[model samples]
Target chain A: MVRLSLAMILCLLMVTSGCGKAPSESSSKIKSQDPASVQNKGTIGFSALTLTNPFFKVIADNMQEEAAKHGYELIVLSAERDVKKQADHVDEFLVKGVSAIILNPCDSNGIGPAIKKANDKGVPVFTNDIKYDGDEGKVVCHVATDNYQGGKLAGEAMVKLLGDSGGKVAILHFPQAESCQLRVKGFHEIVNAHNGKTKNAKIEVVATLDGGGVRDEGFKGTKDVIESNPDLAAIFAINDPSALGARAALEAAGKADQVTIIAFDGQQIGKQAILEGKILCDPIQFPDQIGKVTIEQIIKYFNGDDVKTEILIPSKLHYKEDAEKDPLLKG
Target chain B: MIFMLLLLVILFSVLTVKQQHPTGANAGDQVGKTILAQYGKGARVLVVTRDTEEDRGFAQAAIDRLKAAGADVLGQVNGSAIDARKTIESILAEGQTIDAIAANDVTAKWTVYDRFPSVGSAKCVTPKPYMWPNFLKLSNLMSVANQTAIYAIIAIGMTMVIITAGIDLSVGSLVALASVSSAIFIRDYCGGTEASVTMVVLGAFVGIGICAAAGAFNGLMVTAFQIPPFIVTLGMMMMASGLSFRLAEGRSIPELPSAFFWLGRGQTFGLPNPVLLMIVLYLLAHFVMSRMVFGRYIYSIGGNEEAARLSGVPVKRVLLAVYMICGALAGLGGIMLTSQLSAGDPKFGLMYELEVIAAVVVGGTSLMGGQGKIFGTLIGAFIIAVIKNGMNLTDVDPFNQKIVLGAVLTAAVLIDRLKRHA
Candidate 1:
């Protein structure tokens, strides 16, 4: 009887809560928004993979700035690299009746459902930094770095450093990410082409290790590679953290001066590494531009204008010589 | 029981706060029309969050805005993402159509792709296979089994410790230390080459040996100094974790031989080796706990320590032996985990002790000691694994998943208490 009564009360409570407020009270609160001064522009939501990553944070800030300029209220949420959390953020946006949503997908495939939900709701969705695996038409646009181009630039720089007498090289990479895979593809293709044409210039990839895209994994993987391949001439790290890890391992082995290191992601540490001559050069991405472009696409969508489906923001090469001159290298 | 009732009341109040005072009847239609103007008349919004005061506030605000916008506010669910999805499923089961859902981005993404299959692109890409059908697949079953197997192995020892009215909080840390030590030994002495049968066995022994030594040290400290088991084990936990970190030098040891992985990831006759090993260990634990004299002594000691001592039971020796056995099991668990990940990370087995302990407790082991079953602990481990697998398959929000898990555990204990009283 006690359990039954408790359950009954719970049911009653749930029903009452579901239909608690009348239309007049909520409508009155809604009228508080002055229709005269403020343009009733729709709200735009952004779901970032994580704000802890300075790159993503910069993009989010830029998107906010761009949204304000377009007279739209921006709502930013961080997924903290969890796909489930990102999905929830999208749901929240849909509930708030946001005009559009910008996503930095934690996983391309995992974001399919969220994109589908927005598509059904007629709320345009845009992806920044990563592409979602849903229907092509579902997403209004994808704003991201041209990672393949960045890799090509890195490879070209390596060729210049090698000076047509290329030696054995080690590649530290995170193979799981599509962006990283593209970077590796570009780097490998360029190096292979260079080797095939140039006599006496053979850039043999002695080892390819998975750095798991983190400093600790990079450090450990590099240490293992260095132990196995002491004759390594150069190391190409897919990102700044991996390069830093390799640098630490090389320093520990007292062979830091022997190998030329090139990395992607012109992070603060990587730039310092370049200035310190530890790293040859880094390919830096324009995250702020990506964020601004994402919002621009959303505005275009709202204006019933055709928005390009894909936008590749080019990455720049940051060298030790340019560190002092280029504000981009200031991290 | 009182605490359980109080918690339920608090949960009820929090859930019903918005419903306590309904707005004017005419206000509902006005707000609904407003929502229709913004979105559409057919728009249905479902709001969800983890059951917390703060999350509820967010849900309420969204509900208010949704109401103001003239949207058909379906309801607010304060539970796991899986629970929210289940609610949607039930609503759909009753033939009620849902148009939209509101949640934090993570939960929203997972629920939409996982639950509302008709609307989204059919192809849902996830790092791990999360389809509901996949949960029943042999490979996924094996994956779940593999996870449960490790926890069950560790929980076997934890059950023993709890049976004696003692706790071993350092088992997780011990697993890390053992794994790191074995990895280092294998790399240095065995050439870190492809796993041969001999190398795998040698590595296992080395890892288990290190864990046993650590366990012995814990036992000696607890028995010799007459220190509380909690304090002793807690100290051991930190010391073992520090040792693991120091040995690995803040890096993971990867590239273990294929033979080593065979113990973790390998299948024999469609069953993972780890699952097989877990079953064998459980059988052994069952025998030791139910049929052996040592087990009887442990029970007596826990039931009445003074009486057991007066009855000439070598309490110190038995306690020491029990701890060593627990350590050995933890060592074995570590070796298997290392083989599974193909890496011995110092950060491996982080907070795993809590899970193992929870498994033991949920299996009906009393903290005050004196009663428990190895089979029950095994079931407890599987329960946890199943919950996790189900949540993943259903695309439950990870944060909300934690809440659901906590609630289930509490309810389990409460049910056990009610049974005791009845």
Candidate 2:
């Protein structure tokens, strides 16, 4: 038995050691490129919350374009919605000696230590889309949509669609996200304000279900809401995925035309739904613009220009009429 | 097993070919240029990825795109984020400018910060502490331990089934059913002003009873009809999953009472309640499997069913009892998981059976019959959890992590075979 155990340990050591050698040997073979022959532009590292969300991907694409235009290299990393991975990505950026780090935090509070580390290293960390709940000085600037304003826009669109005589409405919400919460608050405040002033047009929110900002959860939440409130007039979804899911649920329930759906995050699917007349309108946050402005701010910081601490990009309301006309709304 | 490994390699390589080599021949340069335009001109780009064929294809595609855009393309390196950092360091040591790096997001994140000198204006990403301020490390350890404990609880029951020369594929589904049923019962019946700890305990018992009954049914069918355990458990698995969905009505049951939540999320003596429960269960299982007559009978039956029967062992009743115990454990795991999430999600415990079985097999438990230890299964459960947590901490891509885990599992079994031969 002892001999067998020793032999097994030996085999295990051999396999691990063999696996370790291949990477190091390949790394050794890498020769430096001739500096005299090639132009050396600066590199910028960007850590996105997730590329699975087309919204974040669009922002990343825009950042890449802006970086290229400025004769700079942009390295993009996806955090896949993991706070720890995002923290690690920031560390990688610090190691690469990149000029600046652009962060899209998966969790605002969870990214504090990582941002603090970047601050300690003297690396300027810029936030995009989502703000980090860390030391204020640690993050140089935050570029994101005015989510509350977007939600108010959604509210106004719903009111306009319903006219003076407002009916029952349901909300598919993601309460966990700060941005989503702001959106919901803005929406509720607007509708309540409208209701207080105008007695004839009363917009009563009949059901509010947690959609969790995903297709499956949104579908389930919407289905349950529909089962309880059959006479629901309109549904406001926090994001495109939830809106699409709500649309699916409505169609499955055979109440497709009965409810007017308004959504946020004017993604391609949401725009398609608008054009198809399934959804009334969508508040479009310009992810590409957010990305472009983020890089521009980094360049400003590099050029010794004073940068703004907070930049709010306004969201545009896109209805069916604007789907084909507006470049941003077009898929 | 070798053939399976070869097939996976070939399949991944084929997938790599499809992803790398675009079908549009005439528009290749146009497409490449468009893709490369995002990175801009005069940037020296390095691509780092795993040594797998798939990653190689991605690297090659990136190189082709960068070259078409008139950028100085640094050669591709095959390794993890740390190795990529080393390669970048080597290049930098020779005074080459690294303008940009292109790799999968996870790898790029790790490689981008290699040897970042802390200039007056520069910052550093803090290295996570391992030993000091033991609280942080302990918390992380506890999180991983808690996860392992849940899997270990289920796997302990699976170990019993495997020892008796049987398998229970329905454990995962049973977990979902138990979670959903208990949550629904607690919320609908035992909820509101009259809610009490007794009610919560009763709800748990009812849920566990349902699971035990389902397990008893599986055992009876296996013994009475002389059907294979695999087929019977497979059927039960589907049936239970469907029932869970039907009962849940496709929505998660939330807002369980605090007492119920304590069973999953509470802590005792600085350890998670689930972990404490897991340790206690392991002790009980150890006693049952090692010190009891039932445990011996299980081993005897697994060693040779015909001989055990000839020796007057009641094989059918033991098999029946074994499955019931497995079911009850699965129910316990379900309740714990549901409590942890603070909801009874119909989607809970998805594909958990495969993980449980893998843990059992990796713990040196022979599938052919008995010959396993409860302590070994506990170790196996921790091994899987640690690997998962380590990979997440290291920023390994989720896709590549799967490959690494599979390789580790295969290597473990291969080493076991080698040891046996020796």
lDDT, residue A117, candidate 2: 59
What's the distance in Å from true for residue A52, model 1? 2.8
Each model's lDDT = 0.72, 0.72
Error of 1 at A70 (Å): 2.8
- Model 2 lDDT tens row, A1-331: 5345434433443344344334323322331242211122356778888887888889989998997786566767787765545655665555444557898976565466567656655457899989876442378889999999998998888778775878999999987678999998888988888888887779999988889888889899989988998888899999989888989999999998898889998888888878888788888899989999998888666444557899999998998888877566534
Q: For model 1, how does the per-residue alpha-carbon lDDT over A1-331 read when each residue is reduced to its tens digit?
A: 3354335433433343334323323432443463421243546778888777888889989988887786666767777775545665675565444667889876565466568667665567789888876342378789999999999988888888785777989899898688999999989888988988888988889899989878888889888987888888999999998889888989999999898899999877788889888899998888888988888777655433456889998898988887777565544
Interface RMSD, candidates in the order listed: 15.7, 13.8
Per-residue CA lDDT of model 1 for B148-242, tens digit only, reads 78889999989888888999999989888988999888887787856577987898899999899888888898889999989999999999999
- What is candidate 1's CA lDDT for residue A34? 34
**Model 1, residue A54: displacement in angstroms?**
2.2
The residue-level lDDT of candidate 1 at B136 comes to 46
Give stretches of model 1 more than 4 Å off: A1-31, A36-40, A94-97, A117-122, A134-138, A227-229, A326-331, B1-422
lDDT (Cα, tens digit) per residue for candidate 2, span B1-422: 22322333332222212111111222323333543555467767666555545455666666676686688866567754345556666877778866555544323334134344411111111111121221124445576677677789999989999988899999999998998998888888997224699998988887888899999999999988989999999999999999998998865676476687798768899898989999999999899899999999998888899999999999999999999989988888888877765567666777778889888876777777867888778877766665555443333444555666676577656655765677
Where does the lowest 10-residue lDDT sum fall in candidate 2 chain A?
A31-40
What is the Cα-based lDDT of residue A224 in candidate 2? 92
